[model samples]
Target: MEEAMDGGVRFSSLRFISDHVGFQGTIKTSPSDFIVVEIDEWGQLVNKALDEAVYETSKIEPEPCHSVKKPKLNIQNVSIEHESHGEASPAATRYADRDQDHEAGSENEGSVNGVTSECEKGSAGLLRSLLDEKTHTLLDRFASDVKGMWSSKTELTEPSLALSLGKVLDKKQRAALHSAVRQEFPFLITAGSNAEVVVKPSPEYKELCHLVSEEEALGFFKYLDARKENSKFTFKPDTNKDHRKAVHHFLNKKFGNLVETKSFPGRDHSAGNPNTAAITVRFREKARGKRSRLECERRKAVCTAFTLQKENLEMFEAISFLAVKLGVIPSDFSYAGLKDKKAITYQSMVVRKVTPGRLKNIEKEIMKKRMNVFNIRPVGDSLRLGQLKGNHFEIVIRNLKNQINDSASLRERILEAIENVKNKGFVNYYGPQRFGKGKKIQTDQIGLALLRNEMVKAIKLFLTPEDMDDPVNKAKKYFLQTEDAKGTLSLMPEFRVRERALLESLHRFGMTEEGCVQAWFSFPHSMRIFYTHAYSSRVWNEAASYRLEAYGTKVVKGDLICSDEDAGEHFPSSKVHLVTEEEESANTYTVHQVVLPVLGYNVQYPENKVGQWYHGVLSRDGLQASRFRVPALKLNVPGCYRHILKRPHNVSHRLVRPDPEVEVEGSHADDAMPSLSLSFDLDASCYATVCLREMMKGDI
Candidate 1:
């Protein structure tokens, strides 16, 4: 009864549902075998955006929110001026000649009188480095306002640090600093009329301007004004760094204690007065938002929607990558279920409170790094997981050599297979993807080890060899065998940063059992949740499979059946009552619901053999009913119900015979295969491959 350490789902175990060898041949020979198109709650496909139309529509001005007022700053006449140490350097001319729109170099500039070729090259390199450093620093420090201020054609705000060199430095230092600024900062052009430098917007600024207009920006800020009243974040007027740091430290300590105690309003029966201690500090009074003149302008957010095209990228991975590239938090992005990595997928997602121009920058960056990844223009509202009704699939099953000679018989066989599925249905087992690939200990094993307080075992599984081909993994295996955490750090590649981080933690925390487990928890919350969920899902799968064999999709007199219209929100199994004879008669043949429990602290078994089977599965795994209640971690898996049967809608098919003339995009025309193009629609959390397996009649 022990789970397979190899992480392979034995198709033989699912024999109760159907025969394993119904048909023989593999699916997913290529990424094209599986295509996923997500459908929104309105029963419509989440379609691709027409790039040109999307761009044009994004440019249309939005109606302004009436609550906001304009500021009284004169930004129209701002211009940049450059002052020379002695004679102006060639860098000055280069800055002046930089194409306004493109931010590119011009060929019209002449060489400096005394500068050598080598010196020019060095200066140019230094300038490039300094410019990059300066740009990144500004971007990070003022992220919210960077899009608007940096790209404005009419405004040039004062630089955070002066570009001037004072008498405290020598002549050489001053000249070097002067040259660096002139080569970079395109804002510094010819001398201006004012005593101080007055920056003027150039063509470069205009090109990178905000996609959301000022009116829209103001509207969003006004909306935030209403949100701020009940917000967890309390804004304070900008203050000294030391004061802010101390306040942050205090709050962190207080919050940590609060979370550990689980103390909220009206739930304060703790022995110690933690709330009184926190209140005595009065940090909230000091940090509370004040009625500032520019309060609304300071915290504006613009939501943007875009169509993402990714080749073999997990939804979370793609979103995380984009967030890092855009210099934003991953929490800013919202998406539905994770997509398959080996398949091409297109889905809708939203980046909240970000300008379309910045979103465009992120898209451009992704294309540059990964030619396969792309994004259409951003448009409207924010997106969330499970906000959609389902997904539509356009799959191709290739190499069907078992077919009959006549087209009529071939068609009938396929239809019969489909019809069998329509009536008999298929068991909803969590696919192999939920566990992970290859013959090694799965994440669920590590999660189970963690739950059992077997920290050393969990760490070993993580560090031990998973992929032999990967040199870094090979090194990890060696170090794990030798029990040398410190030695592994140098061997770890940059791509294996997570492993390196773990090793570093092991070194710092002294390799104690608790320390190792704490180091595991240090990983991203999503990854930790993934490990726990994998284990919970394993238990659920076993229980469901057992119930299927016992019941055979038949409604017994004592059986609990979910209403077809309920959508499996509250599991019928949890609140079971004896089925009436009339109800059993109606459901016996046309039973549409099969509910299975996902194990958690609150989960209790049903009253009968089915319930005993659930408990037996838990016992075999060396887990108690309350094993999910791990207090050390914040992520207590509150498991829920899952539907054990799903059927597709809007089903159709087509046959594509091999031909040089008939070709699909991305696939080579000459390298064609005689394939069946199968299409269908299924609701959220349902796997298309599961449905396809029933129709294809075997291993896929």
Candidate 2:
């Protein structure tokens, strides 16, 4: 184990399933080579749903707030004074970020009330147009920046807005002045000479109020900031009302409860409508299937089936974008499994509680983008992972020359390869997609870091930007490489929202290993689960390969042999047979099960040759049976079993008609070569690429 850790190769190694193939060919030279059509649970293409099904609406629930201790203030070295200016000065001028330094005035020399630098509006005119364009501009800026301002040591600009502390006040007195400051900032109001007068700030001034704590500012900024940052990252809310409501809900939740005010929670208005005092705040109801199908059509969930024709989008990300556009969470939708990001895949998806009319609207919006990407309809029920009846694939193998020029001989070779795969099947190895895509630092590496209690290392792995050509990302990557969390965070773009959230957490919680781990957990729960599973899968794939090599197509005594049909059931609890001597002899040529262990705490291997191999593999990776039971991290991986063998069903093929135009740019049209098209179906958890590799019978 120690040696393996030192080597680093222990975690990076992966094994292929079909080490023994009889044919030699190539496949997938283009995105079109692989086509996946998801078959729904009812054994039909997931296309659309019936009109009778009702749409389910998710209720908003109040989330319990986690208590974060406030940082204590050091007032010993700070100086405070009381100054009474009988009359208020004019509002300060607005300047650009760079221009602020050149044009300066004495401290608090300008207006006690802030001015509207953009519109040149004073407190007098601002009150009249308070709900107009200027208010939105101020709110948007505050929403976009408050989160990043907490740990930020941004230089203080001259105070644009001030509060009238009736008498002289000390630093402690300033810190205590919270209520007026809090309520005033949201309304873009600043202190003025008159007791009730407040003004706007200069447009050029760029800084946070020193009087209030960063934690207090989070009250109004949390949800609004999230919305703004998400918008920048391409998550557009469904409507203006939804945007306001969501922000309001989060604010109330952040402050522990609704504030006692006339306009505490505002009401929802139509799209583009300005919010009134009574904002509508939504809290989720803790109820499952609250309404039956017969109760109300809109109350129950309508399982809408859809197909996505994607070129370059992750399944989760695509769903997130769609959900945001509709003012819903991605969790509101479900799918059987994730697909490749860089492929032209027509895969299945289902969303609950959305109306057909709403779907049509979503479709129109998608169409406006000029992309023929998504198609939607209604189904009776929502789709869950592994609820599908497996996937059917239509593939093309390209860039290979026929070794035999004779058509009959080439066809014979292809048939022989197919026959070999049909009898023996291919290994159900986890593909590269299971690990992190297009990166040297795989998910399993992060999992290992987690297991080792190296939270700092794990967090670093998460933030380590990929080696790419993006200039903005490159700059952020440089900061990350140097372990400069604040610097990287300051430069990080909105698209890197997850990373930004982590940095903010690190800044707030202190950058210790525990803090980093806690910050890491702040990410979406599904992602954390994915990271752990990737490591388990890597171990399973490597072990399966070794087991197959040791006992090739033979059932040894005490070997757990699962049936092909029962393979889909939980393998760990599935029925298995202890091959007796007579049964082994009788089924010598008919042996058909492969055991792939999903490493976890509850795993128990047979005391056979395969058991020894599993133990050896685990030890080499610095892993033990007990390490799988990490209850502290909530990662108790109860080991399971998976059948290593998978054979495609309803297999068929045909020659693809070559285009007469020879679209090869300069190639002669008459000399165009013919291509082959193969189609087949496999069970759930089986990769179509494995089947293609088996048919090709060569190195991929």
Number of the top lDDT candidate = 1
Residue lDDT tens for model 1, 366-435: 8753323334444444554455677888887766545333344454566566666666666666666776
- Please, what are the lDDT tens digits per residue for candidate 2 over residues 1-700? 2123323324223333443434444555556666677765556654344233322322222222222212221111111111112121121110000010111112221121221122122323432333345643544455345434434854423232222223212323332222223233442323321112223332211222332234333222222211111011111122345544544544333322212111332233443444533332221121111211212343244666667666555666566567766676666676777776655566677777675567667776655432233456555545545556777778776543445433445556666667767766777777667776456578887887776667788887776666676854674576566766677677777555566767788877757877886787656445665677678887776666566667766777656666654355233332444456676777742445645567766555654787787788678768886676444454545556677777788888775546665466643333344556788888877877656555665445
**Candidate 1 lDDT for residue 592:** 52
Point out where model 1 deviates above 4 Å: 1-11, 16-22, 50-304, 329-332, 351-354, 368-384, 403-411, 483-486, 497-501, 507-510, 557-560, 565-590, 659-673
**Each model's backbone clash number:** 11, 27
| Best of the candidates, TM-score | 1
| Native-to-model Cα distance after best TM-score fit, residue 248 in candidate 1, in Å | 27
**Could you tell me the TM-score of candidate 2?**
0.57
State TM-scores per candidate.
0.60, 0.57
Tell me the lDDT of model 2 at 599: 72
lDDT of every predicted structure (CA atoms): 0.51, 0.50
